[model samples]
Target: MVTKTEETQLDRLENQVDNGGGGAWEYLCLIRKLKVRRSEKVLKHGLSILNDPKKRSSLGSEEWTLYEQVAIAAMDCQSLDVSKDCIRVLQKRFPESKRVGRLEAMLLEAKGSWAEAEKAYSSLLEDNPLDQVVLKRKVAIAKAQGDISGAIDCLNKYLETFMADHDAWRDLAEIYVSLQMYKQAAFCYEELILSQPTVPLYHLAYADVLYTLGGLENLQAAKKYYASTIDLTEGKNTRALLGICLCSSAIGQLAKGRIKDDKESSELQPLAVAALEKDYKQRAPEKLSLLTTALKSLKVSS
Candidate 1:
């Protein structure tokens, strides 16, 4: 696990490299380790090491990894010429490598050659049917080609085999949400929760979907999930707090008769309102009056 101190050191190394100091290899490795998207910086500093014979040789077998890194970074910055040079070096060394093949496909992708890229990725998948990266690249190709339905289909097929792939589930869920398919999105979130129950994000997302597909039962369920999020975050999540207030008020409205069991929602509303008021007072005093007015309006309507 990367510590806070390691992260601080990366920052310091970044500044050091920027000042024309050495440690180019250290800085580049740190950026890759942290998965930081300093694309321009990567291109600038990475080439510095690659261009110098001594520094390049110091990496030895790791020189290939640096080539891959610089290639991807160059593509990100649209410096295709540099990307091609780096990729050629890798291809010469690891000609039959699927990893290098992915780079070639990505270069095709960068040049808007969607058809060629798709073909390249498909060939890669044929050799290794369960290749997760290649599968995702296919989905990305569909998206880049403006084929939303195709992207959805690709993602669904990808999920059938890669059921444990939470990132794929998230992408599919967002696609469903974008198309206003709340129930489908809700199902995706449910899968995510089952896969990782302790993650507050899945709980919060499921709550939002249930709230969107609203009824008394859904609102009540949404409130419970929002409350769970507050508990998980130790009451620091402002949006989840607001969600609780909204769900409570909506439930209160739906249960107008204020039946015996429904009294909890009536009480819940006040607690959520108090939490909201306290949060706004501490975080954004300027917005407190507006929040109060909004709460009062909800009360009046109910």
Candidate 2:
């Protein structure tokens, strides 16, 4: 009584099973089809067949592949409980398989069981201590739980193991900046620049930290970095350039006050005026007027 369309659908479902014979992808596809058709009896049959040890011998070379497909499908469906059960079965069947621990941890994380997730990740790290992804995940978890010190400890451990990771160094620098440790952040940014001189964002971060530290001695250096950032980024960052000009004007004013030489102070006056005019054009008139007065005072003093 089935129509041609219904018959075709059933044929497609049957084809999903590897009669050649038996694999994880085949079983997973069959299960998905059964689930979609609401065939509870068939779905239960499939599950029972998967759980039976006697059927393993009959499953041939495709048994492990079928099992992995089932695990992945369960995870994709957000069926954490099912995924965990499948992973446990896999570990029991293949105790020496290296991916079981990772699968178990991923399922635990999906279920928001943080303590169990930590234990699983720690076990992985203990086995493979040099895995950067595992180390970064641990640091992220610590930071998520508001354990900044713990995150820093993890970062320090990672640094001790592998000192050349520019990404990790940038992450640590951002963390320090978040904590308002400007000087430490500046030092970290310096290290990052040494590792990756071409990354404009790192240069911008370095300039921001220098601006925060309130020292004009570094203003010229900050300006240079900001200019480099703008040039390398193809003039795409107007805000950074504007910030640099503002800071430069302020530093010029400070320099004029500090230096006793009239000629040197006079030289700073024109640079400060130019910076102020650029800032004014960028819609920062208040700071622009302030710098204009500073430039006028420098010219009169000279």
Q: Give the candidate number with the greatest TM-score.
A: 1
In candidate 2, position 15 carries an lDDT of: 56
lDDT of 1 by residue, 153-265 (tens): 99999999999999899899999999999999999999998998878878899999999999988888898898888887777777888888788667767887575545665
Candidate 2's TM-score reads 0.57
- Model 2 gets an lDDT of 0.68
- The CA lDDT of each predicted structure is 0.88, 0.68
Question: In candidate 1, where is summed lDDT lowest over 10 consecutive residues?
Answer: 257-266
Question: For this target, which candidate reaches the highest lDDT against the unseen true structure?
Answer: 1
Give the runs in model 1 whose Cα sits over 4 Å from its true position: 1-38, 52-60, 258-267, 300-302
Quote each prediction's TM-score. 0.85, 0.57
